[model samples]
Target: MYCEIEENWRDLDIRYLSFSNICKLNLLILDGERFPILLYDIPCALKVLHWTDCPMETLPFTDHQRYELVEIDLSHSKIVQLWDGKKVLKKLVHLNLSYCKELKEMPDLSGAPNLKTLDLDGCEELNYFHPSLAHHKSLVELNLSGCESLETLGDKLEMSSLERLDLKCCSSLRRLPEFGKCMKQLSILILKRTGIEELPTTLENLAGMSELDLTGLSWT
Candidate 1:
């Protein structure tokens, strides 16, 4: 089953719904000004959760309940964090949190082993990344463009399958993590308008690199 609440509905309360009858629901798309305080009643079989402009700070589901989810897009929301601690999302593949200006924390991706795309563009408040991100081998595209508060990306990245990495406009970031030797499939790397002064020698490992944007970068 699929349900989509129109974006014009500014004051719809999810608490009044009968969740018991919607146990088999698979897709839910909500665009509203404010969301319910808790989302624990959402169906366990849900696969797609696209809630743009949501006002919630955190998601209220356990690891077991979110296991079936395949894609999640909470762009333009006010979420500071997704949930507490690490949650296993084995079936999750795509996650988009773009333009979530208040976002500061990221859950561990060690549990989401098959995750392919992660979009965090315009997340201005995010400064630190979860350690698990450095070793996520299944990620194909990772975008951190416009993350003005970001300073570093740990010491090294080991995502062998990553194809594109966008770090444009990260004004506070001065350095990049060393790319792993297995990252031969990386094709695009955007580093426009960042604080980085030098490139790591490991960059030579990306044999498939087709685009490397260095516009607005100042060399030391």
Candidate 2:
């Protein structure tokens, strides 16, 4: 089952409605100026949640509740943080938070082991990544383009299944992280307009890399 609110609506707060009885409701798409506080009221079987431009700074999911969400897209939302702590999200695969300019923190993703795609492009205030991202084994695509305040991508990246990484326009990042030897599947890497002056030696380990973009980089 799917539920979508009209995009033209304004100030619609559906938090008072209970969705726990809708056991099969799997998709929810909401758009508005005001954010809905329905995380606890929504059923656990929900698989897709798309709530662009929501004004909430945080997702209020209690620590004891577990949801079987597969995809969550809150791009351009006002969220500064996703949640306070890690929740078991074994079924989650895709997450998008692009253009959330006020976003300052990334939640620990150790519980979402199967996550494949993470999009954080244009999040200008985000300066750091959660440490758990360094060891993600199932992630395939990661987009960090336009994160101007980002300086480093942790100490190392060991995502063996990652195939694409986009770091374009990260003007504050001066160095590349050490890539794991097992990252042979990475095929596309974009580092355009970054502050990096030199490439890491581990770039030779990507046996499947077909595209490497280093345009606008200064080799100082």
Candidate 3:
């Protein structure tokens, strides 16, 4: 059951529940709200959540029950962080925080081992990524295109199973991290329109790479 109401929830003396519970919710799509929509233990069994342009500063839960979630799309929201710290979300596969300009940092990714796709495109305020994310053995596709403030990928970062990495249009990025020994499966590396001066010597280590894009670099 879904309803669209224009009333401001903050002005009402609402009871404990204004919406019914769906025990096995798999998909949810919330329209953009002028005011922030506060949620409690709703969508308990949710597998997918799409709340673009939501004004919430943080997500509610911070425990193991968050593991039931598989995918989340909060693009263009005012969220400053994902969670306090990384809790186990083993089933989570896709996370799209694209265009969330207010986001400053992401939680440690040690717990979300099975995450496959992470889209942080257009997150201008995100300056750094946690080192633990490089150890993600299941991540396949990572899109950091248009991240204007991202400066580096940490010195000791490593991504063992990542196949596609898009860094197009990151004008501030000047270097890549020292690739660890396990990045053998990485196949596509896109660095179009970045500020990198020269390819790192570690390029020799990516033997399995099938495509490398360096379209906007100066030859001199």
Candidate 4:
């Protein structure tokens, strides 16, 4: 039987019996269940998973292996971390962890080669990003808006396929990493409401950039 969550499964011990046939799952707004849904029976073929307003401190991964997940959204959760270690998910394209207030770190994303969009907006406690993100050659859009604690980008950003980067409202950010020559595909760069006082002259090298937002900044 397909267990679509219409009501909360209170104190459920879901540690066995794999739902091997289910491909997609969405937990809309089920409440009244205890925090940390002991998930273990999840199928390997699951492609898309969206669990909003989760109270779990961390995800329950059955094992350390690359998943077939293409999209995963854990918005408004208390999760502090996504996974335990590095993983390989070639088809994983999008990952949204917006509004995860307790989230402090990101995992190694070097294996998700085709990842296109990563949304980390409203992650107030996230102070550091995994360095592997700078080397993602197929990333298209990165939304780090409202990351109040983020202080800086990595030492280098070499995303050749990136098109848009949103860093608005990152009040703690003071400096940006040097952009590589591969930033030729960048078209939109948002830097509104940040602590960045000055930008590197290397920014002028983005010949294809059509939109650059520098609002709420005073010339120094």
- Candidate topping TM-score: 1
lDDT of 3 at 33: 61
Off by over 4 Å in 3: 1-22, 64-66
- Please list all clashing residue pairs in model 1, or write none if there are none: none
Candidate 1 vs candidate 4, TM-score winner: 1
Writing each residue's lDDT as its tens digit, candidate 2 over 56-175 gives: 888766686788999999899999988887878889999999999999988999999999999999999998799999889999999999999999998788989999999999999999
Clashing pairs for model 3 are none
Instruction: Please provide TM-scores, in order, for all candidate models, with all chains considered together.
Output: 0.92, 0.91, 0.86, 0.86
Count of backbone collisions in candidate 4: 0
For residues 56-87, write the lDDT of model 1, one tens digit per residue: 88887765455578999999999998777888
Model 4 root-mean-square deviation:
3.3
> What is the alpha-carbon lDDT for the whole of candidate 4?
0.79
The Cα error of candidate 4 at residue 83, in Å, is 0.9
Better by lDDT, candidate 4 or 1:
1
lDDT of 2: 0.88
Query: What does candidate 4's lDDT look like per residue over 77-105, in tens digits?
Result: 88898876777677889989999999998
In angstroms, give how far residue 54 of model 3 lies from its true place: 1.2
lDDT of each: 0.86, 0.88, 0.79, 0.79
Ranked candidates (lDDT, high to low) = 2, 1, 3, 4
> What is the Cα-based lDDT of residue 55 in candidate 3?
80
Q: For residues 1-220, write the lDDT of model 3, one tens digit per residue.
A: 3344334556755344423256655666654763555465535667777888878888776476654779889999998987877677778899999999988887887788889999999998988688888678899999999888888888854788889999998899998877777888889999999988877788878889999999987653
